[model samples]
Target: MSDIEIIKAKRAGFCFGVKRAVNITFKAAKKGKGVFTLGPLIHNPQVIEKLCKEGVCPTENTEDRNIQTLIIRTHGIPLELYQTFLKKDFKVIDATCPFVKKAQQYAKLLCDEGYQVIILGDEKHPEVKSLMSYAGKDAIILDSNQELQKIKNKKRVGVVVQTTQPTNLLQEFIGKLVSRVSELKVFNTICNSTALRLKETKEIARRVDLMIVAGGKNSANTTQLATLCNASSVKTYHIETSSEIKKEWIKDVARVGITAGASTPEWIISEIESRIRDIGGNGDNGYPHESGRN
Candidate 1:
């Protein structure tokens, strides 16, 4: 064994949606006005700290009329909350990801078309909740296939998903749903960026001795990446920063693959790669060189 090697996913880190949200938030922060987000913009503490330095803060309650500017996060908020901000006459800067917007739009359309909209994702997730608002009170949130048995009104069913949900889980949910429904329409609202990252991570995990999945601890997409890597039955570690990587975890490993969540920045990924190289003698593990690897 020569050293650790990183097999980074081509589509990993700051997808178009996340990048747009971050850029909008940073630009608003630069205005140096009283700007507040409904929640942390993107879940990365480092990025949130940087925003805080620029006068962007997060508030849990939009009911407080003192705030001048209310910025929606990437995951978005329920429609009712957005309406509340409008009623309060706050300057609303919508930084919601376009992909997330599509999901919400699909949910609303399904409801308008008289189908019972079913969201395949965590019920508590802000994105799913936001979709529910558009779907009306009749919308159902399904987190797992087991919950499919409880669904009623199988004649007209429409399905959408949280942007960060695993593709396999979404597909499985859809598969189980079709069996129970006479009419099923699926929008496939899972973000393309997330699907691509998951596919790449699985492929890399299969060929590496160990894998490092880096992102914010609370980020749903990041957690999903770690879950996918672990499902490959490889030695996988999920860490937010380079400091969290343990030398013992990869001490006996030859090739190490590294991947980051969609919310992660390139600098964070580079930092982890540098730390891994410091532990091993070299970075490629003496494997045959492939053009444009990593």
Candidate 2:
């Protein structure tokens, strides 16, 4: 077999907000006073399972009001839910990413100023739901510009986007909105980490034979990474762990590129690179300690 080269993107794995949220959750678990989180602390299932082992339970039922502490996920919750939790006498820790908080702030601001708040994201996504709550129940969620047809006779529109969405999508959403609303106030809330990941994914994809996007299959950002890479017309695969790397995908491929979503863990990315290396080599049985990136 010809030697296969692997290029890992430098921006792969956990971003600042995810890192900060995970760090805080882990520390909360150490307190041992029945710590729990509103949801899987982040999108990575492996990390969530490990956190469970560390006594950080992910709870959606939340009937255990006696719980000592509750850590909010990286995506902030609605203001009413936060107040409700506080009223229930739980020691709520706001681990919401600062970027998400900023979006929520914009939503509230737009509502206060009487602009029809339109969020550029999936309506069901926690981040978008949180923003809409601040914008009032009637606030619109525009996952794509096509949704705009549902709105008629609107005088003013204000926009805020879920931070994980790609810049192109946001631009597309905004461009379509220009003809729909009389007054437009745009607060582009895409986080720095997301911008970097999207940019780096394309850069690595263009230079490699096959691109591996590592992160939770359920993660929107991870899916977007794969979509962005595929748009470059390179073969792309999205996997949550090393075990998902199929041999056929590597066969006859001389160069491999790897990039991951913001919520992905570095260890998982390393494992994936090792697996790719093993499959490409002739039972060499050894792999690089660290993946190469640019």
Candidate 3:
């Protein structure tokens, strides 16, 4: 009998915002003949595929005349894009996450108040781009690891973060900026779900011999979990689905842990857990170390 044990993070998979967006899209699909999302509703490809089967599809641009209904992505679209879509004949459904919407509002507020806005996140991420649009042309985007460059003569500075940023990263950056600007206004825009998932994943990584991080490779939060696991010096594999799990990775491992990103679905996590059992896990014992949180 295999002695290997498997544990799953209680906080893993399908954060509130993702669930809300998916549910709204599915509901919309049931009510209409032609429903389209401005982009993939979330970062998970498997979820997107399922939506496609339901007659819900993603359109990169709003140029199609055949588009009858348009749903905003969870990450949200730029202010101008959203405004332009409203002028079209198609019905518009906004499924943007409330947290992301809050960040956008704060960015716009800061800009209008004459504070030079600084956003903390990957510059290329859709969420960050949306925040930048609200912050106006002079706003700056900074990565967590990017060095803080000295500002020339800005007096008041305002900071807003992507909803998925690490809490510690925001704190660290804010500390550095306080001394540089005469007035510093900071909004802790990081979502509580993202913070808790990272904390739980790190704890699981420290206790397990190997970690299986499940989510789309393109998902920012999913990749962040893998990066955190690797930094903890544990063997980690970031997979989109159960099929990506390799037999060799679990060989000789006494304990394996499973964690998923905000966009990951419960079914994907369950499938991965079952795959681990078929490979080398000793069954469901210690499988779900429930923390009473989803």
Best candidate, TM-score-wise?
3
Considering only N, C-alpha and C atoms within 3 Å, which residue pairs clash in candidate 2? none
How many Å off is the CA of 255 in candidate 3? 1.9
Candidate 2: misplaced stretches above 4 Å? 1-3, 149-153, 231-233, 246-252, 282-294
Which model scores highest in lDDT?
Answer: 3
Q: Any residue pairs clashing in model 3, and if so which?
A: none
Kindly list the per-residue Cα lDDT of model 2 for residues 232-288, writing each as its tens digit: 999998999999887877776778999998889999999998888778632333333
Against the hidden reference, what TM-scores do the models get? 0.85, 0.86, 0.88
C-alpha local distance difference test of each model: 0.83, 0.85, 0.87
lDDT by residue (tens digit), candidate 1, 24-106: 88888777588888878887887787788888878888777668888998888889888877877678999889889999999
Q: Is candidate 1 or candidate 2 better by TM-score?
A: 2
Backbone clashes (count) for model 3: 0
Clashing residue pairs, backbone N/CA/C < 3 A, model 1: none
Which digits, one per residue and each the tens of the lDDT, describe model 3 over residues 1-294?
Answer: 345688899999999888999999999999987899987888899999999999999998778887899999889889988899899999999989999999999999999998888999988888899899999777888885345673543698889999988788888888777877899899889989988998999999999999999999988789999999999999999999999987778766779999999999999999988888777643333243234421
After superposition on all C-alphas, the RMSD of every candidate to the true structure, in Å, is 4.5, 4.4, 5.2
| lDDT for residue 229 in candidate 2, whole number 0-100 | 92
